[model samples]
Target: MLGSVTLLLERLGARTRHLAGSFVYAVGFGIEVARQLVLFLFGKRPAFRVLTLQILFTGVEALAIVAVLSLSLGAVIIIQGLSLLPQFGQAELTYTVLVVVITRELGPILTAFIVAARSGTAVATELGTMVVNREIEAYIATGVNPIAYLVVPRVIGVTVSVILLNVYFNVFGLAGAFFASRPTAGVALWEYVAQLGAVLQVRDLLGSALKSAVFGVIIALVSCHHGLLVEQASTEIPQQAIRAVSRCFVLLIVVNAGLTLVYYL
Candidate 1:
């Protein structure tokens, strides 16, 4: 019994140490990426072509799905709220609910989830493949700063993509709700617009934008960190990709919840 307990404690300690080391390494990687981003902004010219392609792939390619999901969610919210809130004589509160749900909460989080699932996994798998194929080594041999040329572009692209997608989400979601209400609730466009304008505060917009930006940074950093973790075999690529997605999802949720709490407090 004593030996078993000792063995368990040893394993736990090893796991704790590994996690601590990984956290420290990730922080270092993020700092390097930030430094490279500043240098690129200052005309160090990391890789404009890579950054453009990354934005194209992660942002532009993702519009259709984001539009569809946001539209559906908004329509459902409007329909349900119109049907239910009227019974309690609180129908006017629907606009507040819409802004709260779509703008301040679900908009940022759902957008983050979509980006993490789509772009995060892709970034990890692509980088892992490069590592496995020794392309990263080739870049190093050629005196190319792989972090600057390869990673920084992706970080900026993913972050910008997530923020833009959240904006798209808010637009489509509110517009869908308005149109959906026309047939069911018979709410005129002007009245709906006025009600939303009244209830939607500047803080709400700032909060949503802040959440999107933070979630974007989290997704990009976690994805890149896991991607570069791939060491040897091709088999490790998918595993690292899976790790990236899982970590991004978890971090997004935790960070979103933390931000929401702070917003309320």
Candidate 2:
């Protein structure tokens, strides 16, 4: 029994190391991408078209989903707080709970989750379609870097989108929570907003941005990787896209959990 336990520990260690390595590689990719972006800004390599398209696809497309989620989550959290706070004789703590959860964590994480589900799946499907059509190979044959041409735009797209969406969500969520908690939670709507001024730290927002940024990276990178790995089979396109999104979901949750640990623990 001890031997089996030891073997399991070893396997877990290896898996951890592998994931850590993948994360580092992803970080490196982001760095390289940033460098290229700087060059693009200076007209060294003009890619305004790609960047504009990215903004449209990533930022605009995600607006409705983020708004709906933020409002629903804000309403739900307020309801939960109302239901539970009286039991502890601390109904006013609703303000603390709402600001902490919505502003610091859930706003960003939820935005990323929704973006990953929508944009991430779309990226995989598009790239997979390109692969099935032999376009990636043709691009490579023409000396175009596939990752630069295909992956970087979506990466920048999701990153920008997730960040913008988080901001929007936080704003709307606060409004929703204020409205939702008015009848209960033992605090006036204005009082809750004012209390948030004291409790919501800058670090909370920074942590949220970092978490969402990492999530954006995972969504684009994993999806693109799986998409590019698709062979000639058309059936493999859907399979790889599904696998990519699933892997991205797991990665996003793991990363979010790690960030939450850093903040709370």
Winner by TM-score = 1
Q: Single out the weakest 10-residue window by summed lDDT for candidate 1.
A: 37-46
Per-residue lDDT over 130-156 for candidate 2, one digit per residue giving the tens place of the 0 to 100 score? 989989899899987666666777777
Which candidate wins on lDDT? Answer: 1
lDDT tens string, model 1, 1-265?
A: 9999999999999999999998899889989999988988887675989989988998889888999999999999999998899899998999889999999999999999999999999999999999999999999999999999999888888888988999999999999999899998788999999999999999998999999999988988888888999998989999999999998999889999899999999
Give the TM-score (vs. native) of candidate 1.
0.95
lDDT of 2 at 242: 87
| Model 1 vs truth, CA RMSD | 1.4
